[model samples]
Target: MYKTLIYDFDGTIGDTLPICIAAFKKAVTPFLDRDISDEEIVSTFGPSEEGTIQALIPDHFDEGIHAYWQAYKELQYMAPKAFDGIQELLDDTAKAGFQNILVTGKARTSADISLEQYGLTKDFKMILTGSPKGPNKPENIVKALKETGTNASDALYVGDAPSDITSAHAANIKIAAALWGSIIEPEKVAALKPDYTCRSVADFRQIVLPE
Candidate 1:
């Protein structure tokens, strides 16, 4: 009896990684003389943008955060939406009597902006944003499980990153690898032996809303 569906926001619910990367570049490039590679920006992902800035630009941490927010808000217009069928899935979960919780490694501010922009602020009951210290999904998953009063055995955590798979297991719950994002490497995610693997949100809908 799966009573809960824990979700990852960036690649699972929304295609937000590109805007995040672009905004980060826009925010920090002014502080650096050299061009920052996309890979470098992505490598600093585990933590929130605050942590990303702390790691990359400690000297101007305060200013970097402020600029990043401005840039993210401005450039987010490009994304402007969530993936198709995401709202349907959220509805399915609710209709099926499963509690929905969002636990992501994204900064709280950026997460709010993205969710609001996508008109999904009301979809989740519990939304835990990222940490500046490091990847905190494992702990947050545990927190969600406890908050929902659901046992780990009866819950599923869905995410699109390899680290997501790792963190889900760390929290002792079944994980569904969401390989729908363009940037996701299917082979890499499948290699982790996740409990369920969905190549698209439609594929995932079947598991949660089977007829």
Candidate 2:
């Protein structure tokens, strides 16, 4: 059994669709001279917010990223809701002697607020957020293992993006793709071929961590 489970926050644990779309729109409006559709915004869901913003507004990547977070923080505080059954999954995993850690591309301040607001703060052993200088998910996963005193083979990573699977593969941790979140298409996730694919929190428990 996996002793440590690392989670991705935005689309994996928290339903951040509203805030994310809002942020992207707010960040790009001034530069694009035309409104960005929610569909366009939603398509950028997998990457770090900064990276997404950069891709959408290249010349002003830094500025747009900063502005996006500023707008995002104001709106997201009230926007996030935990995915149904996630709380129960966390509880069961904890009871089964697994340690949970959150690794997100969101800034720490915003991530902390979201976790607390959704009552998820207590569910995780540690929460890591993106920094301009911070390492990517793979490096962060290695750090997480060291901090938790777990070997790579004993850890598993659950997330909604290709980046997450790539990071887990780089870190040599098993990967489980969460289909319940924002990815929209299973075929997109299948491209990564995670060790496991879960359609819901219940499926996660049964397929990825069966007793």
lDDT of 2 by residue, 1-211 (tens): 7899899987788777567777778878898978789888766544457657766899988788788878877786645578888888899889989999998877675687678778888899998777544337887889999999999989989888777788899999899988887544577679988999988878888854577
What's the TM for model 2?
Answer: 0.82
lDDT of 2 at 71: 83
Candidate 2 Cα misplacement greater than 4 A, ranges:
37-67, 77-79, 133-135, 208-211
Per-prediction CA RMSD (Å): 0.9, 3.1
> Taking the tens digit of each residue's C-alpha lDDT, what string does model 1 give over 1-211?
6889999988888888888889889888889989999999998889989999998788989999999999888887777888889988898789889999999999889999998899999999999989999999999999999888999999999999999999998999999999887678788788889999898899888887887
Candidate 2 collision pairs = none
Q: Which candidate wins on TM-score? A: 1
Clashing pairs in 1: none
